[model samples]
Target: MKITRILNKIDRRFHPSHIYALQPDHDLLRENRTYREAKDIVLLSYPRSGNTWLRRLLANSILEAQQYPSSIQSDIPFETVVPSIYTQSIKPPCLHRYDEVCHRIVKSHEHRDARKHKTVYLFRNPVDTLVSWHHFVSNSPSLLQQFPWVVDLSIDEFCLNAVDGWAKHIQQTRHYKDILLVEYEHLFQYPHQMLANILDFCRIPRSNIDLDQIIDNQSIRKLKSVTHSQELRKGGVGHGEVELRPSTVTELRQYQQMLNVAWKPQVERSLMTAM
Candidate 1:
């Protein structure tokens, strides 16, 4: 067991692709300015809002269609298909390749910027998102150390903080003309249709692509089984109903009111019933 743990640590430390695991407060905007400027497509979301899942789906679809090497499969060093500027290490070979790729698909969790990239904004219910994020950080020692508040606060307190951040993120980017809004619930419920919609929005041809294959490949179970990382936790929807405290539900409702989110009524109703 000790040897196995040691090997796991070594693999995580040296893995080429693990470099894309994002650190808190990463200065991706400043470091990746040139790549961002040239990128034609972006997948934007708040942390824990299904960004990785969507990235994997898009990567598998596009790479397979292009007949790229199988070595760069969904969760491997597959950032090239859709480079996540925020998470990818800004070093030599990756940096050089990022600059060279045209119409690149970049992932970001930062506030919306003035770049003209066609954007897909993935959002989830703040309640579930926070719950997932709380568990995610709690499981990741590195992430918990980076954001110590995750350890300092109860899940309720964390959700309260998360709601405010989620509101601000939504307010910042929801108005963009070129942005496509894809809700996590919708994606969970209708994977194929949602994938098709995303492809259509991105102007990618869906006729030749097998949506079912992409959906199967990116299913939550498949991702969790394949990845050794704890990031992919229980992938079902609406866990907040059972998991979140009533106080957190109230806090989220108030935030929705303050932000004047369009889905406020629906979310509030859900929260009330959940509580």
Candidate 2:
């Protein structure tokens, strides 16, 4: 099994046919299928909602605190540390260890029932999410071709559709046994404090480095420079207000208000404890 896990890692790394491919492997899911202690932390969000950015931040913090060799730390891909279940196999060698020395951070865009994992739900303003998602899908030739109507939809129409999806996701994930709500806007506004809350939620203590230093080192610009990733767009607040029609903005805000009402207690509790 150890050899198989190693092979799986190599297969994913090099994608050579000679190596064994264990992708689509449900071993981890099946192994952790039953409810147990030490549940993995899931970083949950909708697409284009700052999942990658937050993942990078979490991964950096974990690696530093765990005292992983600087060589591996420097070269290890983000997915190697915080993998996406949608794309990466779960049976990689890096994931075999489960302890304080090696914490698991998984990225997920979907929710499943009957799981006992702790979740950190990244909530972005739906209006901003709608605009960002539109640009994201529109830019992809495959997505545009598959959903031709997507290109034709007005911002209002897109917002209507996007809001429904957001509501459904929120409704689905709200019932998780353990959940932490981290607002995208608040992360930027109160980065140092918000990051501390997130680390504490995930049980990741800061290394000798200060919290402000961690935030400074993991800026979007630095991450982009390191990974050369184009997925990160203009990250801040008020994109929806700037681009969407007043009516559309009003509708999204109404839905946002409803969500706020639903999760107000959790949000308030997290805020109070964050300090």
Best lDDT among the predictions, by candidate number: 2
List the lowest-lDDT window of 10 residues for candidate 2. 11-20
Candidate 1, residue 199: the lDDT equals 73
Candidate 2 lDDT, tens digit per residue, 1-275? 00112112211122111111232344544443232235567888777788877876777666667665332125666677777665554554645343464457777665652257788899888888878877776676755554566666676766666576676667777668788888888787777878889988877877643666667767765655555454677676886688888977888878888888888687777777776
Question: What does the lDDT read for residue 130 in candidate 2?
Answer: 76
- TM-scores for all candidates? 0.74, 0.78
Displacement of the residue 175 alpha carbon in candidate 1, Å = 3.3
Q: lDDT (0-100) at residue 203 of candidate 2?
A: 77
Give the root-mean-square deviation of each candidate in angstroms: 10.4, 11.0
| Model 2 CA deviation exceeding 4 Å by range | 1-38, 68-73, 94-99, 207-209, 224-228
Q: Write the per-residue lDDT of candidate 1 for residues 1-275, one digit (tens) a residue.
A: 01112122222222111323445535653577554554467788777787787877787666555544332244346565666766574343563233232346777765443346688888887777878877876787776554554566677765655565577677776457786777787778877777777776776665557778777767888777778664566667887757877866766656645654575454344334323
Residue pairs that clash (backbone atoms under 3 angstroms), model 2: none
The global C-alpha lDDT for each of the candidates, from Candidate 1 onward, is: 0.63, 0.66
